[model samples]
Target: MRRYLPSLSALHAFEAAARYMNFTRAADDLGLTQSGISRQIRNLEEFLGATLFHRSGPRLVLTETGANYYRNLALTLDRLEEISIDAVRGRSVDSSLMIGTHPTLASRWLPERLGAFIGSYPDIPLEVMPAMPSTDFETTQLDVAILRGVGTWLHARSIELFPEVLAVVASPALIPPGSKLDPLQFAEFPLLQNAGRPSLWLNWLRLAKLSYSGRIQGTRFAHHEMIINAAIHGLGLAVVPTFYIRQEVANGQLHMPFGEPVQSDDSYYLVYPERKFHNPNVIVFRDWLLRSLRKA
Candidate 1:
């Protein structure tokens, strides 16, 4: 580490501020006062010798330099978090939870809401990894997993956080308002694909009574957020879990083409090995997760 490298505290404040574009919200997320958040960002700007934000009458907008810096810094922070967790273990006995989850929940859902959970349990840092549909108790030393499935996993205890709801969403440019679209009408736009569930489109089409004359062709992405971003960019239509796209849909960046919500046979679940079911950390997280979900 060099003395010239920006401090992690200042960088973290800027990253949260950049992501939300609001100092007050960022301050709340970081558990700092509004003035404290502004001070930290100002310190970072001075250290970098470039203006990161244009503070315009109560609105904090990122400058071109800040926008570019934020983008790379965000990725850097994610990798740093992963590396930090991997290189270290619990600071003391029962002080952390080794978590496993899919990218969509981790990226779109957890990071934003994690501040509250951390604020409550500051001692138990989370060491998170990408998890499979079924937790690998034999191969991995994970304490818990957030998986998307029906309310069952062999040899594991589980609970459903919420039922998975899906919607056929795409960029509004692809499907304008008041368009009377038959099920097959959607085929006119290319279908984006999720590698985890290759048959998602087929099943949804079957339920919706849609038939396509042409082949469904589009890019395949491993993460749900990737497809959703592509859909927002007008690349193709995507059948995605509703929870993941609420913000985008609400912001009018994405539109529902079919105007009907699809209920999936599965849902998001928190699972852990039955043998370690009584672990205090796991139990606390499970309770907090369910309570938080209810509150949300």
Candidate 2:
């Protein structure tokens, strides 16, 4: 006969206690009394024939074996929870897709082009979440994400959505009339910078073969919108993504003085976990996104 494993409830109690090193907190997390949680851990340890915790006064510490076991168990449990949640959510929604992306991209780029996607997949409901720096896709209920990076996704499989072409853009108001100065003359104005891409201005200048005294001097902002707004107001020239400022340029709010565009290694990518590739919702969303990019 094969041996039976302990119940999930007992294993969960043990994991919580091992993590917090406090029965009271574990009880709170599990919604059980401190004594009840203790009982569960004791039962689990007894069933396993090993001591999982060392009780020292009010504090609890994991033994060497307990530490090793907890490390492996926690990882397994986390993955299990992820899979369980995915399965449950997948069954609940047959035509809904959840996507996550940076706020700037969602605001400036996706809004204009998403109508095409909606037109093709009229039956599918697309849910977009503005993912912040701290958002983790594995823990969250996200089906896909559009991320900005140097084509590297640590855990997720990534596909290049678009290459970022950066250029020095300014309002027509800033340039003097009948003044056709060389590229180095750009150093005269206050430089607007993007905090996420500090080296953008320098890279663009280098690509234009322009030399300036204050190559690295500039005022930096966190979002691309702020940089564009500053440039539109004629505060200074900004190195911004061409796709982001397409509407502004068309409206004459911003002007790219340089005839050439500079391409950056960093670009937008569509990413999702390898396991989710076969999911119907994920597949539909990925295909729609790729098609939209192609049209753009």
Candidate 3:
């Protein structure tokens, strides 16, 4: 057995230098002077009884042994880092309840409803993760996700929260005086599109049994908030989700021209891994969420 277990500092220095292939750059990355990095690498090389670097005029090249050792050491260190992160996050993963949601839902809906949940379960700490629609829930530490889509997630139990309804809306200033425009007249205005749901305007039009070619041409935004802003700025008419824009409408920032909303196939859903259903926190959150939705 080789009696050399290299110092962790030296090993770290060697790994940094090996990755950059330049001592000065490695030193900058490690927040150490170039000389300090060089000494650490030398110490590591001596301990291993092998030459790790071939020093030229201003460049350091890895020897064959150095290359092989670095490959193994880099993999080992990466695994160790992953393990450490997993260990730390494991405590939260097991005890802390994480809820992932879309930005609009988190900002407009969840905050108002979470008070009751927090009050009911005083012992459980809730962590809200506002994530993108493309976030992978399995790899993430999130225990549950509230997503806006048709309930079709794989390997998870999903409960429908509510049906999403959308309508053509704009600021009061945008509605022209003496303009008694019906749903069909919506084609005349500059339409705004939600980039995430590009077909929203079309779907609403289809539901209304009206066909207009101009629905495809419009300003597009990735978030519901941006669409709301555009409508509020009198930029154009937007087909916005009713739940998200309720406050804006109530506050007179936005106006709904139509009497009825266009119902969408899309719905809000609460999803959790099947195995996590037994968790006490998950059970409490699911029950609270269902109750709140019912009350709403």
Best model per lDDT: 1
How many Å off is the CA of 30 in candidate 3?
18
Tell me each candidate's TM-score.
Answer: 0.67, 0.66, 0.68
What order do you get sorting by TM-score, best first? Answer: 3, 1, 2
Top-TM-score candidate index: 3
Write the number of the candidate with greater TM-score, choosing between 1 and 3.
3
lDDT of 1 by residue, 240-294 (tens): 9888988998898887867788787888888897866899999988899889988
Flag the better candidate by lDDT, 1 or 3: 1
Clash totals for all candidate models: 0, 0, 0
Against the hidden true structure, what lDDT does model 1 obtain?
0.82
lDDT of 3 by residue, 1-296 (tens): 87658888999999899888998989999999999998999899888899999988778899999999987787678557757766877743356688999887888889998888889888887789876545444344467899988887765778998988888897778885345677777767788888887888788888777867752678889888888889999988998889998888888888877547888888888988675779888888999889888887
lDDT leaderboard ranking:
1, 3, 2
Whichever of 2 and 3 has more lDDT, that candidate is 3
